[model samples]
Target: IARIAWLSMGLPLEVAATTVDSQCGSSQQATSLGAAMVASGMEDVVMCCGVEMMTRVPLGSNMKDGVPMGESYMQHYQPTSQFMGAAMIAEEYQITRADVDAFGLKSQQNAIRAWEENRFEREIVPIEAPVLDDKGQPTGETRVIARDEGLRATTLESLAKLEPVPGQSIHTAGTSSQVSDGASVVI
Candidate 1:
């Protein structure tokens, strides 16, 4: 997948591929590893990319073996611990449902404005997707998927209708980050 992304972006093969699995900190781990390798004179130039296409591979699917737990650990120890975005953010910031709703609304508005202004053109590489007619025949032309898939125009009233998440009862779908597909590369 890294190779495909690199080639698609016209990046060279001299770039190294490092995959990290630290849940939310996977990319950070990859970056630290890359830095260490360069500091040790293993390679001067490194390309690091972190991708979590939750749509393609849902979280916890890769952890079928289950997480470890024992009597030595308490409060934070569980056989299958998974942290959702809203829960973690709510716990960290003591954010309420109202605050989350407002943030979600702002994100949607900003993302829409950015899309309208083509603010992402420089970073985006348009890929051709097959265009099929109603009869399922392919039109010679292809559709461009240049924008993000998660942004949705929402209102506070609509957001308020959502049920609070379990445990803290602070997070809702509106307040949490969208389940999305994204890829980023650094030189």
Candidate 2:
């Protein structure tokens, strides 16, 4: 995928490209490796990149879906999802549901405000996306997508009305982090 994406970008074919995987910190790890390579005079520049199509693959399913995790990893560590980790942190810090809800409401409000003021207008790079039909085929038309799609308008009342996540009581869907389809690069 890395090589394919590199070629898709019209980069020089001579530039080396490879994918790095370090679990959740893959991008950050790539950045570190790139920096080390440059510092060691191995490369003049490096494009550190990472991507996750969470809408299609979801999170924490790679191991179950056949992305090898040897027996030792299975015996020693179990995946504690981000939501579960957040709950643990809240429990440790004594953060209440009310506090979490307030924070979530503030974040949503800020996102809404940013969009309203067009603060992200310059930061976002518009890309042409195909207009898909009911069957998901391209309809011979395209649209420019230039803004964040995950922002929501939520109030304190709405957030409070939501139910807690399955096992954790400290954080609900509104308060916890969400998975999204995205890619990122640091050059």
Number of the top TM-score candidate = 2
Deviation in Å, model 2, residue 186 alpha carbon:
3.6
lDDT of 2 at 123: 58
lDDT of each: 0.70, 0.80
lDDT of 1: 0.70
Q: After superposition, which runs of candidate 2 have C-alpha atoms over 4 Å from their true positions?
A: 22-24, 35-42, 59-72, 130-143
Write the residue-wise lDDT of candidate 2 on 1-187 in tens digits: 7899999999899988989876567788889999999999999988998876664544444335553556788788886777788888988999999999998888888989989999977656788888889865899999987777778788889888999988878778787666665667778
- Give the Å error, residue 89, model 1: 5.5
The TM-scores, one per candidate, come to 0.62, 0.73
lDDT of 1 at 67: 32
Q: After superposition, how far is residue 79 of candidate 2 from its true place, in Å?
A: 3.8
